[model samples]
Target: MTLEQNPALAPVSDLPGPQAWRDIGVVCPFDMALDHELWRWMPDGVNLIFTRTPYYDQPVGLDMAEEISDHGEIQDAVRSVMAISPAVVAYACTSGSFVHGVQGARNLSKAMVSAGAPAAVTTSEGLLMALDALGVTRVAVATPYLAELTDRLTSFLEQGGKSVVSHEGLGLDRDIWKVPYATTCELIRQADRPDAEVIFVSCTNLPTYDLIARMEQELGKPVITANQVTAWGALRLMGREAVGPHQALLQATKG
Candidate 1:
């Protein structure tokens, strides 16, 4: 009955075969409807499993932010994700991750690890890491959140060492997934400043995977989106090279 003598309990080999595949788990908010967008950019042989944490469809405001960041719900989601035994786990929500600030975000990731995730990440933490990797100091932000949430996002970035040269929001709380890509493009344009180094589009529910390269081309700078950074960070945690569509952040993998 020793594990050494039991093939069933043996560790998987590094040998390349059918059983060799990477699994990335995501803890998404219940209100989010755009997890498919992340799948569009996932590389081959990598599987993404998502567990939706409790979230109200009500407006994305302070109360909603507070509710989504509940340690209990996050822990529950982490436990659910752990059941899949993924290589890494990510809390793929922007406002929820940053609502309690940077320290809170770290604690969220730690919670995931304590819940049995091999590694952990959060959307806000991913955004900051992506920005740093791109060596971007000044940024423009566009979000589907209301003014207060937008302000909180800016503050989070600012406190993390990035300057929010410009920021704008649609003041939206409902049906964020319904927001057209054209509208997000315009919001980024409006938020773009003459000296902004990059554009960041917030909200995991927002459709952004397709717009990243095009927006970067038009704006002549990197365009980082919530889902993009979340995926990138999780892939990094798994020690895999960042792959997917042509986005500036994905291209800049060093550091």
Candidate 2:
């Protein structure tokens, strides 16, 4: 029988309700494995749900291209998350966000809103907002993508009005999550240029939560990662303060 025919499939509403709680949904890429990093930053009383867009493997360009082409799949995922009645829905793929450029990111968010989400944001769009909030225009970038895809990101950023002082990539075609924190750290160091006002580490699947604050401290500048900005944007959509010690973006949200 279909879920509609099964009474047991109904959403649980009889359970004890918290005094207050919020639900946030993440529409992720198919190969995503770093969702736990988003969860790690979630405040108490917020529930995080995930649904995947079509993607398989990577070098960024291929996987992200597939995701961008799967507009139907992405809309369906957003609608599915809406079924849970989340306060905001996030398209949580960085490459997918900027792949089509700024207008594309805006279009993606519009589609999510059309899908019934009360509000929505994509990672690339989020990055732009986060950068504005931080008052930064010059940035250094590190990525777990090939040179071509990295070039796409730099162009996207430049189009967004940010100056990319330096950019570097690991040139990996797959297994991006396997990249260690130490490697990412070194990439940031190597990507750093004297004039860069901030450092941006791209890719939602790359693990980065453990060291964002430490990186910022060591670099003496903001070290923004994909997951952190994604989470921060969703929180902003929720009309809630994103409070997390040591995370510069989150800390910046405090009044």
lDDT of each: 0.87, 0.86
Q: What are the TM-scores, per candidate, against the unseen true structure?
A: 0.90, 0.90
Q: What C-alpha lDDT does candidate 1 achieve relative to the native structure?
A: 0.87
The number of residue pairs in model 1 that clash at the backbone is 0
Of the candidates shown, which would achieve the greatest lDDT relative to the real structure? 1
Quote the positional error of residue 147 for candidate 1 in Å: 0.2
Off by over 4 Å in 2: 1-19, 55-59, 66-69
Error of 2 at 92 (Å): 0.5
* Tens-digit lDDT track of model 1 for 107-197: 9899888888889999999999998899889999999889999999998898899999988999998889999889998998998988999
Report the lDDT tens digits of candidate 2 across residue range 27-110.
998788888888987877888999987656545574555455366788999988888899999999888888888888898899
Candidate 1, residue 145: how far the Cα is off, in Å: 1.0
What range of 10 consecutive residues in model 2 has the weakest lDDT sum?
Answer: 62-71
